[model samples]
Target: MIELNWEGVYPAVLTPFKENGDIDFEMFAKNTEAQIKAGVHGIIIAGSLGDAAVLEMDEKFELLTFTIKVVNGRVPVILNIAENTTKNAVNFAVKAKQLGADGLMLLPPMRYKADDREAVEYFKAVANATDLPILIYNNPVDYPVFVSLAMFEELQLCPTIKAVKESTRDLTNITRMKNRFRDRYKILAGVDTISLEALAVGADGWVFGLVDAFPKETVAMYNHVKNGEFAKALELYRWFMPLLELDIHPKLIQYIKLAATAEGISTPYLRAPRLPLVGEEAERINKVIADGIASRPKLD
Candidate 1:
């Protein structure tokens, strides 16, 4: 049976590259350790922040295999298998299941701008190709395709469709889905800035890039909200709001990787077609991150 046994603070890990730009397995293992040490609930591999756009098929499988082993069969590892083609993505999902990944999270098909009907068909295509539960990723910014609420209902009827990452950043859509499908599929927050608000609107948890920076803070805030400690959660949310603002930028991978470096985790390295944050933008981000860290509240 297709089941979405996923929840809590799952950080989309950055694919660490060597100085020569190859996938650095060592650094990737270390990053997993960092998240685990911080009490993160789970780990996601090969997502947008992992530089999925630039990786080849071999690199992807390697990362998935490495992730499964590094997580040591403890946390559920959700693999982002978003390819240009649904068939290719499904193939990756099947492979991930073979490697014992917990679930699959897919992006909206980006190359073709299909109508809602065709888009729904694309999801079915992937669903049929794999037995693992699927989480439909909706980021209108990168994928920029909007799946209607009706389509969401359709996906719910899909045997393999189990969750929605709901990156639409649409409050109305989020609220409507929460009301309509409250007892059904999982409602997860895909954006960092509104993660807490998304939880307010009934998100189960968050999959955020900025969590790479202050994972302990995010974990604390998540548990606080989950445990009904809203006052404490909101205080941490306000303190971390500035970093969340930077998470939506196109250079999010770059910025979060920089934050990882700041914490002595990993380097700020992105592959081709995506450049590192530079100039005044880089300086401003550095200052904001440093000042925010210095002034972050103590929840102890």
Candidate 2:
């Protein structure tokens, strides 16, 4: 089993598509390289921001394989498992390990809204099926299930379940988890808007969305906070807040891809049933991206 440090900024990378809806491995490689160049601690492929819900199983594996090749062990390449059934999740976890993934970002059973016990069982079932280190994604606001601190107590029994992506959007939970677990589990801030605040309170890392586009600033902000340069971190955070707010929006895929496109790292194309942003919506989001680019902070 490869040990993942599971700290620092890890991007829930977006899957870029060509206009005809094909996975653009070239663009994907470019984006992965950009993340590596910006010094991200890890790369999470097939995540929510990656549009995993719409991706075919084969497509997911291909993306995973390609990312592992691109990263080439410079940093961990964690796969995201967001399946609706325990059987499917377990199968994916097994395949992920076989395919050379360093770790996993596991979500609760998707769409069905499993309760706490079922959610815990679902996680444990997958954990028991594979030796990969798991980071339980607990985002009740976006995802239907919420893994509370009490539930985490149950999860601790499964040593493979090693970390928590704390996306409940409650800053207090950071302190609560730290106070209770005290390093038993790594607590990563999953919500982008409150990441700096979460870090201040004691988040071990950030599982971020906008880092797909603003990697340098995102990474610099995390490094600043981790190094206790709060003033510099805040300066970057205040400038980044407007753009960071885009990550929480429903159209986050389009928003973040636009930011990446603005940086020349990604194309703005999205897979269908999802369409491109247009009209006032496009203009509005473009302004946010534009303002962000115009005033991007210079870090040393």
List model 2 lDDT by residue over 19-137, tens digit each: 88889899999999999999999999899999897899999999999988888889999999999899999999999999999999999998898988999999999999998999999
Task: Please list the C-alpha lDDT of all candidates, in the order they appear.
Answer: 0.81, 0.91
Candidate whose TM-score is highest: 2
TM-scores vs. true structure, each candidate:
0.95, 0.98
Per-candidate alpha-carbon RMSD to the true structure: 1.7, 0.9
Could you tell me how far off, in angstroms, the CA of residue 131 lies in candidate 1 after the best superposition?
1.8
Residue 252 of model 1 has an lDDT of 83
Clashing pairs in model 1, backbone N/Cα/C closer than 3 A: none
Taking the tens digit of each residue's C-alpha lDDT, what string does model 1 give over 41-66?
A: 77878898888888888888788888
| Steric collisions counted per model | 0, 0
Error of 1 at 285 (Å): 0.9
Model 2 residue-pair collision total: 0
